[model samples]
Target: IEGGLLASPPPHQYEFARLNLTYVITSKRKLAQLVYDHKVNGWDDPRIPTIVGLRRRGYTPEALQLFAERIGVTKSDSWIDYSTLEGCLREDLELKAHRGMAVLNPVKLVMTNWDEVMGVGHLEPCSQPALPHAPHGASSDAAPEGTEPPPARHFTIGKEVWIDREDFEEVPPKGYKRLFPGNKVRLKGGYVIECTGCTKDANGLITEVLATVVPDTKSGTPGSETVKVKAAITWVGVANGVNAEVRLYDRLFLDAQPDAGGKDFIESLNPNSLKVITAKVEPSLANALPGQNFQFERHGYFVADRVDHVQGRNPVFNLAVGLKDSWGK
Candidate 1:
């Protein structure tokens, strides 16, 4: 727009409220039905395209900026792949987000030798660098100086720890490196443990995993290299881990071009788009603030709930994006 004798807009000017990157745009006529019919929680529902919706969904400004640069503005219509937008989010948060461990499907692992090796009710201190390392070929200037330990997330490990259920199997799958009877794996940043067996309920469900800790093999200490393990699994101590409400959000539409070809977009709505689960996270995450981002170690990137997350009380988070593109995989 130009301010002259008459203020006038430049050629081909239009209102650009939020950047549109090949996603379906809801018509203004149907906005009322969406709210009245309870199809969505509100206009700010994460599934929608409103400004408040995007912010609540943990879509960072940098990610959107990258998305715009990726699929530039064009006059001609084109069906862009939806995964392109998700790829931008993963790239942006990989270098910036804090690192933490969370167990979405938790199973208890009992260290049977805890009292014999350590104390009876001891909790061994364990720490990991909050921002472990940057992406390959990125600037190395952000690294800490020599012998100065990087910023650490302090937590503890004890007789009982939580592990993702997927990391263990009773019947060995061809070449699984994770926990099984007679298999050994490191409890990341902690100690090397050897799985003895597991206990099952009357319904044939595995209830508890039994493992013995290898003495004097904690990571980063002398004799820590005495045992060699192929896989190291991330875990949260039962003594210090906190319970959190984590909502796993996925794509709203199963079809890439749900609104195209005069198709009924409502029919393509993904039924399993959202899943809420109680998760066990390390103590460091207890202080995560609204709009803050973190890489949930093996899981993916997540953001603290903007509306529901309460500091040191009722913790909640929403899945922002996965660590990799899981499209059609």
Candidate 2:
């Protein structure tokens, strides 16, 4: 394949074109097999999103424009580290999205003081709309300059919100600080809470957790104060949340250099490549249309699937990438 791509100005232009177009093989057959076998949905499946598909999957135009500039027009096809691409994406999104809470793998968190301080209908919206910067720029001072900005987003705040199931453990791991009996952790963008205990189902699966919300530590309030803690967990408002179909995607192949070996490329497909889950998203995202990008607090970057996202119907989201910390490997 390298020789084929590098082969320049051949003995015959037509022959070269034909060979270049035909001799080069694509895994279209294997992809089709996956679809036929019912392993994958279709060519435009959210799990196997292409660049164009990603664009359709709610990637911001500004982001792609910036990425194009960052990549430049380099002719050399060297081994570009995956981190480089991920870095570009992170740089693009850091300033583009509004911060909101979501719970991907939910676990019930019940505040023991639930009815005491925060009563029924005591939901306060939590949203970060100030953003990296306010919109600006105008062709002329009289052209209404910048139009009215979008309304601020607000999420419900109360004593109960679902958290990630993985955030807790019966016995604390060496470095885990999320949830354990007698352990205290900060609910990110919210308040501090102490884990009193949890209840398990008949099969030993945790059904609910008992915690006490600290009265002095509601985020951004007058009395809210930061305290030292190893872990900060995320949450979502139960009553004011929106249900979404979140599709998690990983690299298509397990082996990075799948094509390197002259063997069936299909063998390299990752068995656990895609996972779909019904998730709870902030209310602001519920009304989102196709191609809307969002950062689901602690989960990752996501976009509404253009092919399936409908305003009044089920909202479908595709995972763009995980958090920035995993890059550079």
Candidate 3:
């Protein structure tokens, strides 16, 4: 009211709107506290609800727009569940993200029959769809429609490949489909193998799993289509794979309504929200540029860190979200 006329507002005022997302608070003071109190890594932590944080976590603009559309414009205060946002992200990424393999908490799998079949130290060539869901000419990496897709990106595999340590168990529960003594499984995009057994150190910790390749079971080979297996596991060849720092992010708060019921919101913090691991990733992943997104097949969606990733340097990847359903309420 500088000169008796309100300069910024219209003659008629509009009602205010409130956005209440579950498990998130839009309070600057509280967010600052989280940073200063060492409750979070920083303002850009993926667990935070700020726009900078969301961008760093690989949340796409399309997904945010979809979320806004689904929620519409609410007059009264409303709480939208976190899954609603995640669902939009999943939908957006399903068709846009490239697929790759990465193994966190890796365990060595040695091909006992490799030397006999492929010769000692031989590297076998393999390829995967660059972007299975991308439309014609949509990505710079994509081949033009109707053109023989450029020879699929090639990767090499030796006698050893790394698999997720959790993929095996001494005694599996009901319906377990991964590796175990005498069990058969397909090495995704590679070969079918039957577990011979595993070697353990003095501490009873498995050091290496031994498996024999089933002849003529290489995917895309003549007999591969006919040979069916209970499970197909992802692997990163020791000779061709690259090591990367991967950060797994989970829900920050354990409670659906952390600030509800007069409870201290900080008390609901999830202790295991971020876990860092040295992961074995496909050779191509080492070239992943900042902001590039990929689906770490069977694991989750991830992105090269915008600020930390550099070609030929140690690349950092952040788990955008898991392939599983919701992160609970």
- Please give, for residues 50-79, the per-residue lDDT of candidate 1 as tens digits: 668778878899998998898877665566
- Model 1, residue 247: distance off in Å is 0.2
Question: What overall lDDT goes with each candidate model?
Answer: 0.84, 0.69, 0.85
The parts of candidate 1 lying over 4 Å away from their true place are 1-32, 134-150
How many backbone clashes does every candidate have? 0, 2, 0
Q: Tell me, by lDDT, which candidate is best.
A: 3
What is the lDDT for 227 in model 2?
58
**Model 2 Cα shift for residue 260 (angstroms):** 2.9
Q: Is candidate 2 or candidate 3 better by lDDT?
A: 3
TM-score of 1: 0.89
- Model 2 regions lying over 4 Å from their true place: 1-40, 46-51, 57-77, 130-150, 226-231, 325-329
lDDT of 2 at 234: 80
Candidate 3: give the clashing pairs. Answer: none
Please report, as a residue range, the 10-residue window in candidate 2 with the lowest summed lDDT. 15-24
